[model samples]
Target: MKYIKKYHKYIGLFGCLLIAISCFLPFIKYSILNINETNNFFNGDGKLVLAINIITILLILFNKDKTSLISTVSIVVILIQNILTINKDIISIGKLGYIHFSIGFYLLIAGIVICIVYPFLPKEKNIS
Candidate 1:
């Protein structure tokens, strides 16, 4: 449980950085290079990835007892979105596209693992 929480924290941090890069860099490249593929990647499913990143940030920020329910709900929504996107080919499979698919898959798996292990973690006792 401790390890899961630790990894989740670190992974979430990495996710933030990846989202920032993925959202901005390609768009900037497209503008400078006048490339259609870069623009297409950003304008298409990138929007969905950005939305998921926002939700993930919210979930991580509100992960304590008061917001645990919301965290769980957000995680579930993310997982469902991942499944649907993968099925619909919104998440592509290739050298150039594998990063997005990999991140989505890892996020879904990590969220589920965290949720499963969360309940077994030790709770704080109220001090009188």
Candidate 2:
């Protein structure tokens, strides 16, 4: 717990990095109409989510209050959108294998989770 409190900012920054990277990576893999295709976050409705995450990261970096409501709201919105996209049905008459989430989707979800939890972590004290 102490370690987490002390390193919370670093952890949050790492999470932000993950979120940024996920924006460019493949978000999902599916064959629409039997045509193999891959899509990244910006390729679809994920663009808004990406923008939200960017704003959230910026807020987190500059805001003194780690537990700011806006930060939480942004991450929550991103998470909700990712979950909805994952569950939404698409290409029903395609291959037997169901649509699978790519690494990007998982990364974004994980990053958002970390960001949400980081604020609750105890604030660190002066080390010097």
Candidate 3:
């Protein structure tokens, strides 16, 4: 249980870093091989993605009392975004889209897993 808790924390933190990169990579122009152009998406309403990422990070970091609530909300937002993107068929279903989709999907799954396993973790004793 302790090992699982530790790995979960690490994985969540790592995912947060990836989310940050995906959120902020746009707004800067740089040509790199295999990396798709993100500036176009960033120019539009895609900024909302960044906003959600920021909010999710904060909620996960400070959600001691409401972990399940926060996780549920985060998962729902990610899942909705993925569904909308797929349904609209806007972005090209290529390498970049795959990267984006996979990351979002993994984040949602991780949040769900963490929420489910959270109760199994050892609780901190309150010392008076």
Candidate 4:
């Protein structure tokens, strides 16, 4: 826990980096009888990732309590969006494999979790 508190910000930053990189990675791929396509631009969670990234910046700029609450809300929003997509089958990976999960989505999700956890870290104590 102490180590987590000590490095939570870094973790969050790494997550944000991952989100940015994920934007360029192959998010989904599809193939059909005569054509194939992929979505790497922002992918499925691009907008959400953008939101998380912005909120992460806010978390870093603000103090505790407020940051914590905002972080929690951000987490909720990401989860909600993920859930909604799952329930609605928004991506459509149909019989033709219209869409498929890619490395980008995994990286994006990892980054989001890390960012969300950062706000709950314990503040560093002054040894001096």
TM-score of each: 0.38, 0.74, 0.42, 0.65
Clash number by candidate, in order? 0, 0, 0, 0
lDDT, residue 47, model 3: 62
lDDT of 2 by residue, 44-77 (tens): 6566766766676676677544654466467667
Cα lDDT tens digits, model 3, 56-76, are: 556556644255346445645
- lDDT string for model 1 (7-89, tens) is 55454445444553444343211111232233322454556656655665665555543344354455456547645754554
Model 4: CA > 4 A from native = 41-48, 61-94
Best by TM-score: 2
Which one wins by lDDT: 2 or 3? 2
Candidate ordering by TM-score (highest first): 2, 4, 3, 1
lDDT of 4: 0.63
Top-down lDDT ranking: 2, 4, 3, 1
lDDT of 2: 0.71
Q: What ranges in model 2 sit over 4 Å off? A: 32-34, 65-69, 85-88, 91-97, 126-128
Local distance difference test, per candidate?
0.46, 0.71, 0.48, 0.63
The superposed Cα distance between candidate 3 and the true structure at residue 36, in angstroms, equals 9.9
TM-score of 1: 0.38
